[model samples]
Target chain A: MLRELADILQAEELCNTQGDNVQIDIACACDLMSDVLLHAKAQCLLLTGLTTTQSVYTAEVADIKVICFVRGKRPQRDVVELATNKNIILLATHLPMFESCGKLYRNGIKGCSEV
Target chain B: MSEDTTAQVLTAGRVQELVYELKIEDAMVRDVQTVNVESTMDDVRAILREQKISGTPVLCRGELVGIVSIEDLLKALAGGETKTLVREKMSPNVVTLYADEPLVHALNQFARYRYGRFPIIDRKTKKLVGILTKGDIVRCLLRRLEMNHQARERAHYRPGHLFEDVVSDKSTLVLRHRVEGSNFQRAGEASSRLKKNLLSLGLSPDTVRRIAIASYEAEMNIVIFTQGGELVATIEPNQVTIRASDKGPGIPDVELAMQPGYSTAPDWVRELGFGAGMGLPNIKKNTNEMSLDSKVGEGTNLRFTVYTTNPT
Candidate 1:
């Protein structure tokens, strides 16, 4: 599913590893780290616009394995290093957050609560 | 809509609501450690070391009074004040954090104060419910990244598209090479043939590189370990799939052999430094997906795929 999402959004891998087999139980598209912390699952695909070391830290704390930056917002090198150290996959996509979430929802992806 | 208007809407649509809605309670630690105000500096130092913490809030009869840190302890000890009470050394002007406040507010405090941790006070009870640290905030935020990679397992369905027709298709060419055992000098013959084929087809540099690595590794494995094998490379519109099957003493342990540096090659093969046992592992690493099926005596069938235009 992540591969499909990447293809749809024209996403590029900012990090080296690919979680091709990693199961993403839920999909959340939000820039607010607090909301994600409140409602995220252990195996999730994060789609957000915020590109910062704090964003990467927040995702790792929430146990999010894959993070997709929307609207072509790639994380800085330091953020990439932090995510890499934590074994989190980072991708950047041209699609905005709403459209990315909408496509995933249309393709049977759901929020963590629904799953 | 105008391009500028579209951009403005995207930036403006959900700014304020998201900014004010997130609070410190969502990510703060609830169980806070505190030091009593009357405790001696030595006692405070011991607690910090035992807990492996940098600091803690100082409490006096259930009322939050001040905050103390390891730095404070060091400063006191440096001044030869081991007998001084924590009340004398702790920072009395405690910049407390409210759980109900916006997380950004907490972030601002962290930036402004340069403190390692803050004592979080519950809004209604007005008492310390938890400790908020920079590490804690990082952890909480990382935990919230929503990653649901529920990709449907569609195996290599890339038929050429209209626009991509001009660029090229991987399906146009199919090449096969015969590798004979003991042909040490000609071991890389098949791999070079496939490389020439891929390069001639005008494929992407990344795709060509991946195919080259997998094919070369596969070829080396066939020549070094097997009686002989046939190497085949099939190009499809979207990806390249390579299959190499040998007719020799089959690998009894596919998993173990797939590990790097697990070569069962004879002393001669090792002396050649050609079989460092990385062939199979290299093939697996270069390809996006790999499947290996083998029996004790029959043979081994190895297959891998590399996407052409885009990385899978």
Candidate 2:
């Protein structure tokens, strides 16, 4: 399911490739770290435009396993290293947030609130 | 047990421990009002009205003999026996608690025997030492909790004062990180390192997550707002305390800033996917206790504590 979701978004895996076989049924798209902390649940896939180290820390705090940076935003080297050290899967997609979320929703990936 | 029942039990766990820790003498009224055994029912009624008490123990020549209650007095008055002696109407078999017994024993006695009050007696001297009512227990517990809170407040102000009294070898991990203003790239490094350290310390995942979230928000605030600040986390055996202090351009109105949707952040910070005005609220939500102190033209110091023993 994770590999299929990544394909639909045309995302490139940046770190933690072992999580490619993992299943992700719930997804939340947000750039704000506080909103993700407030609303996101554990094991959900995160889609955001922010590619700073804060994003990786937010995912680690909220227990989000995978993060996909939309709008073709690639995080710096240190951010990717941090994600790898945290064992969180990182993906970068060229599609914008709207298109990325739409593609995932079309392929049976439900939003966190919907599920 | 169901989750709800388990939560209820855990919520009452502090009071349960308090009852076992306190002695009956600590909460009992030391000066007990008494009436002589030979006193008449009219005298008992007057004593009850004057003392504002529902019951009084009857003493005979410096010895506790029985207890005269408002119910006994009312019964005598209705039966036209208002002149009856206190001994004639008093219940001779009085249930009493020993002064040295734990307060939990008194609680059990109160639950088992539906009495409104219990006379406490000294075990060695066999003398009535005090009287205990349900009100006394409630007041005692409340006072003790207040004292504990005050002590914790004092410790918070002094930071490491709680560890001073410990002669035994205790490991306290101190983590300090400095932040630079407007540095978005390294905003969460402090909290990230803190999370790893806490996980290595074998703290529960829930507690570690809470501390991490709180510290991350504090760290981001320093990065986005002030000229920079220092975040210090002191990890103890039972709790963790975090202090974030900045240098200049302090907030004028902290109460307004604490609101959920209020933000003074510039457009650049907002463009970085932060400053939605939920950072402080998120910090408050994750930590068990939080305090913010700021003075205009001075600086802001935000401190918070997360209790490991009781994860909220």
What is the TM-score of each predicted model, taking all chains together? 0.34, 0.57
Please tell me what DockQ candidate 1 reaches: 0.02
TM-score of chain B of 2: 0.49
DockQ of each: 0.02, 0.39
Candidate 2 C-alpha lDDT tens digits along B1-312:
543453344238677788889999999999999999989999999989999999989999999999989999999999999899998999999999999999888877876787879999999999999999978987898899899999887655553343444445876767888988878887887888888777766677888888988898888899888899999998887899999999968888888999998989898888777889998998999999999998878889999999996211
lDDT of 1 by residue, A11-69 (tens): 89888465676666578887754345445665688888877654565455445789899
Query: What's model 1's overall lDDT?
Result: 0.73
Query: Per-residue CA lDDT of candidate 2, range A1-115, in tens?
Result: 6778889999999988465578899899998888998778778999999988888988987778899999999999999998998889999999999999888888888888876
DockQ of 2: 0.39
User: Candidate 2: where is the Cα deviation over 4 Å?
Assistant: A17-19, B1-171, B310-312
